[model samples]
Target: MTGIVNDAGNAATYAYDASGNISSVARGNAAVSILGFSPGSGAVGSNVTISGCGFSATPSQNTVQINGAAGTVISASSTQLVVQVPAAATNGPISVTSPSGSATSSASFAVTQSSAPLIGGFSPTIGTPGTAVSVSGSNFQTTVNENSLVFNTRTALLSAATATSLTTAVPTFSTSGRLAVTTPFGQTTSSQDFYVPPGAHVVSDVAVTGRMAIGSSQTVSLTTAGKIGLILFDGTAGQRVGLQTTSSSFGSCGTGSLQILGPGGSSLGSTALCNGNYLTAVTLPTTATYTILVAPIGTMTGSVTFTLYDVPADAAATIVPGGSAVTLTTTTPGQSEVLTFSGTSTQRVSLTLSEDSGLGSDCTYISIANPDGTFLVPSTLLCSRNYYSNVLTLPATGTYTIKLRPYGTNKGSGTFTLYNVARRRDGDDCPWWPRDHADHHGSRAGRVSDLQWICGPARKPHHESGQHSLVLLVDFEARRYGPLSLRGLWEQYIRRATDLASDWHIYHPPCALR
Candidate 1:
């Protein structure tokens, strides 16, 4: 078309076959521009990029060299190029070239193996019957099933295993131990236990026999040869009953139901079903104080009863504030005794002479009266019903004393018991009351620990708002005082509660939750 032709203005051209082999080539000088030099091709495993081919076609070359290295060509153009490097190639610079120009880029490739699984922990460490535990581990696949692993002889459903973790419920009929863990790659073996001890005494109380009505209320005590089990008051049966134990190790309430009966053995409708292996308190349902009978229910067993009479209160003597002599006397058989007083007077309390008709040692009594009348406490004479005597503080303001005839006739005497009550120190400024009255009373007097008895499980069925009365029937009977004193036993319970409270603040286990 143009008359003026320039040899230097012509374009070059090339060509190739479908197999990427050079087929034809040409060079242009001026007039006619050579349009086909042809694009380059590569092998299947070859790294490639396509660029710089000057052709009217949008995609002239299907593939070409990637900086003379093997890779995958993602895209190519006249000005730039892109490729996925072969796994065998380390990160390096890449370029593409054609008849017109070339293009280059920085890239890399990589291959890696799967990761390992992680473990959280095993469960049911105690190993109890019918206990369900979980084995927590990470790195599991979603397509797990029975064919996955032999879990306790059963096909375990290969559970959902994710890139992070996996879970499966423990199979039934599994052994009482830990199980094995299996994965696509390998297997692991481990085990755990499932039981814990119920920490408490597993025993009960015993039965009762004769009962009597004391002072204002009808009461009864149950006494056996050894330890007692259940001590209940059957208001329905009009009987003060209890269940005693032959064996000291276990008792009735440990495994049974106890009820308070009325006249004719009819259920007073009070029943306490022992929920724990050992119980702290189980009361009798009766406004009238009665004893309870502990009986075994099902396979459980225990025994206990209520016995022993207790005096409500009595006069305890100490020097009066007006300097009057503190007169002390024993209505029952007076034996072991101790008297204490505190005030301003510094005079010794004398024995104001005791009169009794029963026989036995009378004058061989030990009496301790503060010479300066500052302080006189219980005499270490150990006075039982076997001993009898009277002690008096003679106008002693600050001191106290107790007289005890350890070996003597105690029956029919006006005073057959001893009183060893404690009082405030005399003459030390601060003065308290009730000097000598507790010792000579029933069983053990004034000791809060003597109360190991419960009253009733008598359901105060939900009625009108607050119509139910709290009927507490107590039966305090001695079985064996053991080596522990009443005061000591009470202290132990207090200490236990304190320890539990402290632990609640620490680990704060599930049971401690509100």
Candidate 2:
């Protein structure tokens, strides 16, 4: 204020001090006005400025309000002022306040959520042709449409829609395999193949009787006479009798008579001798009883004599005390020998017989104490009457005697006879009677011994108390070598097993054998 004053116009003034410093000064006051106020389209925060108001201004008496709400100003000057933009103050008009007044401007900000909806996978991917498939995706809308989901090569309708996924019903398509899916923003496909998965030949009946039988033929079938062949064996080779048919005064009708035709079709023995059902003769070939039909002949009608007898050379057989007699060396039909024995105590004894004639009649019958005839051994002893013959074990050591009983009285004669007897070091006689504990099929305790004879009949039943009169039938028609058709053998095994089970309380295999 201590200076020389210089006055020019009335609106201006200036002054100079004695030390050459200008001391008089004057300020020009201007009214505060927000001429230019703008915000970014998506701008947030309260950073506002009102330029051209004054120079070098500061936030001394200036403040701001975001969205009309009071807020602290960060920086204030003549040109700009900045304040914190509250989170809730987005997308609204912002205001600033100076000493002169307040100014407002339009503003907008982008809004964002915490997260976006998402989906994972679908269950039970397989379905019928026209089934609804569940879709899984992200950012889904409730307004489902064709653009929401898609099916590969199949027409689909969006039946359901949600924020997380949609369900689309599939349409009928002629094709098969994996399917694909798509949406507005992305696409996905199935990794599996769909398909429809595919649905045995089943003998109906069988019948049989005698040598001739009827049944369902297998892969191969035969229908001729010579197509059938027949051979005889005494557990070894075929005998010497040619097969022939006759049509004379004594000729056989239908299938003709079965004669033992020699080399020239001439009857070897008398043709009349071989014309009956069960033959009983003292003189004939051991093979006279074996007349098996070679092929499946449907049904049989005619009959032939099966003669069986005991030759005189087999008499006076060696007998073992308390057991059966020692067999002879003659294999002939109807050829039985007698034995004489004298003893006491009745300890168990056994005998072995040689099957000379395989006519199915090489059995032994003991006349022990008159009408008290039991099988020389259990029928199991006669397992196979072939080359390696059978051994029979007897029970009790006593004065007993027996006779070599031929099977059919016409077949077990001539050639082979009984050898010596031996004992089965392992078990006792087959428990068919008094002793009643053993019942399993594999139990060998009461099998066969060497002193008894399992003659005549097959699979003899075990009896309990008193001595019973037993009659056995020799089965010589079974094959002993190679493969056996055994068509009816199961029925026979069942029959035998049932008999043994009832008599001895044993459980055998079922009625069928493989």
Candidate 3:
């Protein structure tokens, strides 16, 4: 095949092979054409495939340049060629040339860095100020000048680094945010956020209890603004722990508060500002180390006394019908002892508390509580007296708690006896109501009439029955006035009844007069 073209008044002839392929073209100059290229953009040292109409079949003679840098040709064909981007290449147009002519691409090829930094993960994801954390990744430079670690936009001081790992101290101002590492190539950010612990003062368990004193105060230094002082204690489940703070002598320093924080920094309980003293108690939720955070609410600058007490576990004992009496004593002010006993519904129990004669103060009491920490009967106060006793009928079918504590601020020792009482037959000692056949011809006074009939003589009773009957009468009177107020009307009635019963016992007086 042959074709003719007029080139500058000179006739140029183009010849083709019998297979319809270009054999040789007689033109003034060798022209080149660029159609397209695969992967139009790449980084340095990356292999790029360029496709266009070209004249060269030998790859070594063909030259490819990107961004003014010479590219190494890997292979060449009549319509396609592969070349490696030079290391010094920049973002610019690509050019290809042969011994015949040269062709420039219409589009530019982007030349970027070879490898970007990648983050795998970091150790000690949660930390506080000055905490050292190790970050592991790839493409990190060993030189400090070329590599940098940033936490929440704050630059961290690098201690050491390798190609895949870096060690740095957490910045003081760092917060909870993404961590990023930057190199000469590019920057890579962590997939998750690193956690920074809330600022707090680290304190030991012994330091909290041994240093702070009552009445006398001590200064608590804070490291940062609004900082909380943390005290850690190892605790067991089912243990009762008490925290009390004496009134602050800050004078004008400002107010502060205390909180019981759980294992995970959750608030369990707190105390209110009462004068300067605050008290709180909690039963441990789990057998683990717990954190107590003492934070200032306003301006905290004064001295305060902090106290912690671990209440002993309740020593439980069981009592049956006509069981032997058991005695307990209060060892400290506000100290409590718990006794557990099981009984069916409507079972009657008699509890007796007698102050030790050797002691001068009458500051002791006893209370009955249900299984779920609710009061079944209010507490009984036995102050300024030698002996006190009461009888209660159980209302629920479960274990009952007999709680004994000191009556007032002073800790006074006393002996307490508890036993199950058999319900009196024939209703002789029934202090609640009169018997069925007995005449109800008394004044209509509410509790007064009930007290008179219970304390009065039985219709056919004589001998030792009066003593036990009188004891029940006093117990009913004490119950009427509550256990805490055993001194006023109930004591007077007891004194009068004891005198009259003693006279009747010796003289064998008639039932109506007695």
Best by lDDT: 3
Measured with C-alpha atoms, the lDDT of residue 283 in candidate 1 is: 29
TM-score of each: 0.20, 0.22, 0.42
User: Measured by TM-score, how close is model 2 to the native structure?
Assistant: 0.22
Q: Is candidate 1 or candidate 2 better by TM-score?
A: 2
Model 1, backbone clash pairs (residues 3+ apart or across chains), number:
104
Candidate 2 lDDT, 7-62, residue by residue in tens: 32112223447786766543323343333333332223334443324323566576
User: In model 3, how large is the Cα lDDT of residue 126?
Assistant: 65
lDDT per model, in order? 0.33, 0.36, 0.57
Q: Can you tell me which runs of candidate 3 are displaced by over 4 Å?
A: 1-228, 234-240, 250-254, 272-281, 285-289, 320-324, 330-335, 350-375, 378-391, 396-398, 405-414, 419-514
Please give, for residues 338-370, the per-residue lDDT of candidate 3 as tens digits: 667887789877665555543325344567887
lDDT for 398 (candidate 2): 49
Instruction: Write out the backbone clash pairs for model 3.
Output: 247-276, 380-483, 381-483
Top-TM-score candidate index = 3
Model 1 vs. true fold: TM: 0.20
**CA RMSD of all predictions:** 28.3, 35.0, 18.2
